[model samples]
Target: MLKSLITAIRTLTLFSVPGRDTESFSNTLFWFPVVGLFLGLLQALFGYGAHLSGWNELAAALVVLGGVVLTRGMHLDGLADLCDGFWGGRTKESILRIMKDPNVGSFGAIALSMHLLLKWIAVLKLVELGAFTFIAAGVLLARLTQVVLASALPYARREGGTAQAFVTGAGWMHISVASLFTLLFLFPLLHQDLHALLALLAASIAAGGMTGLLSYKKIEGVTGDVLGAASELTEVFVWISGALYLLLSGNG
Candidate 1:
């Protein structure tokens, strides 16, 4: 179990831990939310401290950077690939080919720009509201969405790939365990504000579900890029929705 946890950590982030990974990620998937919760806690703590110190704006950008640094920008690269391939390609073959390309096209550049801008704005608003604890919610749900996604879709790469082991081996048992890990951290967000948390969970479900639907239609299944895109989208959706909710409720 400890080695499996290390696999989850090493696979998900740039964090260096001493241990060999299990041959397969079926069990490693169980630790995904655990890694996410760890990332969320660090981000939330830094954001909270920055808020108290009156550097919330800089902290917001750094919070965004913290995620990228930890994950090594893999998810952002996936988002860019998804945008470039899905919009620029005329067929499935072309889509897959384009996604495999290392170059980011016009579509990808625009997507990265808009996505980063929106994420920064949403995060900035959240911190400005003094609700820094909720920062963990978005990060936690992002990783959980990936776990759900891996379980929901067949691996798209026919020749096998880095994510095939994780995606193909996933099941409900994995999701259930990951979900428990996710919720264990939520109680500290608002003490008794589960309604908002549940609503955010629903929002994440919708975001992840939409990614699955689009990936299914695009290439008839999922790739590593698809899973990464799902994580990126779900995190931003939760943050955007939470920011809006707080603003509308006069809590901001």
Candidate 2:
């Protein structure tokens, strides 16, 4: 269990876990959300502490930058690669080929720009509303969405890839367990505001589902980039939903 937790941390964050990774991806799956919980907590702390100490805009920017730094910007990079491939390629073969390229194209650059802008806008609104928990929830839901994506689709590459080990043998049990842990952790942070909590969950499901469906249609399966894209989209939707709720409730 400890090893699994370490593996999960090592996989999800830049944290230096002392031990080696667990060989089986499923063995490390149980702690995915736990790793997310740690990230969310740190993000919430960064946002909240900044909110208390600095300007709202500063807090928002700091939290946004902090999250990217924490995860090494892997999710955003994945989203960029997906944008370049999904929009630029003429066929599945071309799409995969485009995505594998190390260089970012026009599509990828625009996608990254839009993603960061939208994220900053949403985070600013949440910070102004004193909704730091929503920031944490957004990050947590992002990771949870990745678990579902891994379970729902086959690895797109026939030759396999870095994420193949995690996605190939995933099943419902993996989703259910990861989800259970995710929701349990969320309940405490989100329980007081049922509407926001429900909205967050619904938005996460919608985001992940749409991402998976798009991947299936475009490439017939998923890759690490698709999973990253899903994670990035899920977090964006989660934040948008929270902000929308606050607006509708006259809290924003």
Candidate 3:
């Protein structure tokens, strides 16, 4: 179990969990959400400490940023590539062509900017609301969407790419492991606010639904870009949903 957990995180994130590097385990499909949970755990520990220490919003934000930086900006790169491809290309073939290119286009730049700005603002708001747990929960929800995409969709292209392994078939057990780990990581916060917890789960489902539909229509399947987009989109939705929950419930 310990080794498999590390394998899941190793395959999913930029982190290289050290151990035996046999091809069979190394090539195993990465569980996206499980990686997110590991990342979230780091963010939660650091962010909570920052929040408790009376750190400003910017400092807290930097803690979250640091977690991504340590992961080598893997998801962010995917988000940029996805934006470059999905918006720049006029047709299906063109989109795939643009995605295949290594260069980052104008559409990608704009999309990335918007995504970062929104994320920054949302994180700041969460800090203001004292919703540290929600921040962690948001990370979990976003990553779970990645697992759903990996399990449900086909590879968008004929040739191999980043999202190929999981989409091809990572199996139900892999999915369950990812999902269960996410829940365990998140369970600590559930004792604080049940409604917020449920809201995060709901937001996750919605994010998954949105991603699933978009992938079906736009690419006819999932790709690295699709998975990345799902991560970012789900993150955003979780933040929004959690914020709204706090507002409506008079908890904030």
Model 1 spans > 4 angstroms off: none
**Model with the higher TM-score, candidate 1 or 2:** 2
lDDT of 3 by residue, 157-204 (tens): 877786675566555665676678677767786555667778888888
lDDT of each: 0.86, 0.89, 0.72
Clashes of each: 0, 0, 0
User: How far out, in Å, is residue 9 in model 1?
Assistant: 0.4
Question: Tens-digit lDDT track for model 1 on 1-252?
Answer: 888899999889998899798877778889988888888878877777777779878878878888888899999999999999999998888998899999999999999999989888888998998777677889889999989989878887777877898987788998999999888877676556776787688879999999999999998888888889899998889988888788887777
What lDDT is reached at residue 231 by model 1?
A: 94
Candidate 2 regions off by >4 Å? none
Q: 1-252, model 2: which lDDT tens digit per residue?
A: 787788888888988969877778766777788888888889878888888876888888888898899999988889999999999998999999999998999999999999999999999999998988889999998988898889888999998888998886788988999999988888888757777779899999999999999999999999999988999999889999999998898867
Scored against the true structure, residue 15 in model 2 reaches a CA lDDT of: 84
Candidate 2 residue 83 C-alpha distance from true site, Å: 0.2
Per-residue error for 178 in candidate 2, Å, reads 0.8
Model 2, TM vs. native: 0.97
Per-residue lDDT value at 182 in model 1: 83
Q: Highest lDDT, which number?
A: 2
Error of 3 at 13 (Å): 3.3
Sequence-dependent TM-score of model 1? 0.96
